[model samples]
Target: MASKQAQRLAARQQLQQRMAVKAEEERRKRTVLWSIGGVAALVALVLVAWGAVTVFGADDDEAGASDPDVAELVDEAEAASDRCADVEPSGEGALGTPTEGLTDGRPAQDVYLECLQMSTPDASATESCMYTSVDGTSPTPLSVQPAAGTQKMTIVTNLGTITAEIDTAGAPCTAGSFTYLAKEGYFDGQQCHRLTTESIWVLQCGDPDARGAIEAGTPEMAGAGSPGYQYEEENLPVEAEANYPAGTIAMANAGAGTTGSQFFIVYEDTSLPADYTVLGQVTSGLDIVEQVAAAGVM
Candidate 1:
């Protein structure tokens, strides 16, 4: 009986020893798992930081390679988006086609407006801007001469007399604003600020200082800046399928509803979405555009 009891006690002691060894092994395993998890977390954080640095780092070479004319267009687009950043888009679309006199496409002007409405800072939105039911037979006129009932003004330069007709029917506010500025002689004596030879574009005579001057954090000269105002998109007409042709006088938008004193004359007929207000056609002098281009002010 004593030997049997001794064997049983020995077996019980061996069992306890095995349980302790297993517990120690489990503890080691738990520690290793936690250590591995911590290392993985550190590695993930390092990768994220490295990715951020790579994505946003400055690329001077890439910027230098970009065409200046294209850059200017991009800048204008950014400015336009920034100007309209605050305005929310309404679902209602504009009244005319995507290209009024030119070709046609999908997505109406309201969709473009929506894009400008939703665009973020440092981004741009685009659409096919058109004015149709217009006479496609004649290439658009170089100088505008308004009909008798329309609002018109003539600016005489070395090239000859250039007539500008305000489109009251399509863009009343823009037309009115332009007429007001012209009557005040806002464009007179101001040199065509930027003349791009390669693009054949002329941005002329609106800056109070004819000399090139840029405002800090702004594109225009100090005096040329529109003093805090924008007009509603209600007056403008738009079409979904067509785009506005060259020689169409349109209001350059800063963004949604942010039309201003600055305007653009399309030197070459290219397709632009109905983003700008087409005020009128140039009835006569295009040589003046060439003359303005020859005189560099930018």
Candidate 2:
């Protein structure tokens, strides 16, 4: 009897010890799982906060005009749009400036956002409308009264109320550059030196003086006095379907990706592959272009 009792006690003690070991292991596993989840949640929160800061923080001037490739692209598009102002819209032109207030949660709102996002200045970057918003209550809906600032307007030579509707929507950077330089009087009294009627149809202006017909325009006389900054092309209208008829005010360049203080006016519609920036068409004073052309490099 004693031996049997001792054997039973030993068996019970072994089983209890085994159960304790198993329980300890399970507790450790639960603790480890909880700790891992906490770390993951913390990481996710940090990322979300960082993204918000980047989106809503104060705009950086350097970053605002950042992206050299984009600036060059804007220059080309603006120039091309200018030269092709009278051209009709084949489809779309360059990619438009991205507006960020469009990511609403609703399907239609999201679709509208997608369309705007996909909207290109020309058919080259064609995209279809994905959604439409009827109620305007989409998650990414723009504010009814958002802050769209009035860009500064600068007239280089007071071409007598040279009225123009600045295209603030299409090329903000380029527009801003022009306005900034103009307000600072960078192009005051600059002469229209070059008039090419063959491959191009424009009377290029912005030479400080038009004394002689220099073969290659010098930097001092070329469109060189702007803010020394360039912009990428945005929201270019199709050349074939543009509103700028003949006698349109436009921008000119020396070669590809070269546009600055110089401006031009189209007298005839000539087909050229080179781009000219169609900033704003002369609403009232197209006669000025004709007069300057008649005067020729004086």
Residue 263 displacement (Å), model 2: 1.0
Could you list the CA RMSD of all candidates, in the order they appear?
20.0, 19.2
- For each candidate, the alpha-carbon lDDT, in order, equals 0.44, 0.42
In TM-score terms, candidate 2 sits at: 0.43
Listed in order, each prediction's TM-score against the native is: 0.41, 0.43
Runs of candidate 1 exceeding 4 Å displacement:
1-149, 196-205, 209-224, 234-242, 294-298
For 129-161, candidate 1 gives per-residue lDDT tens digits of 222212345221111111112445454443345
lDDT of 1 at 94: 31
Please give the lDDT score at residue 87 for candidate 1.
33
Per-residue lDDT of model 2, residues 1-298, tens digit only: 5699899999999999999999999999999999999999999999998887677542322223343533443344344333312323132112223223422111110000001000012211211111223234422111111112222232323233234555544444345445334433445434444554334456666543332223243423433433343333433445563344565556655554545546666765655433666665555555544543343321
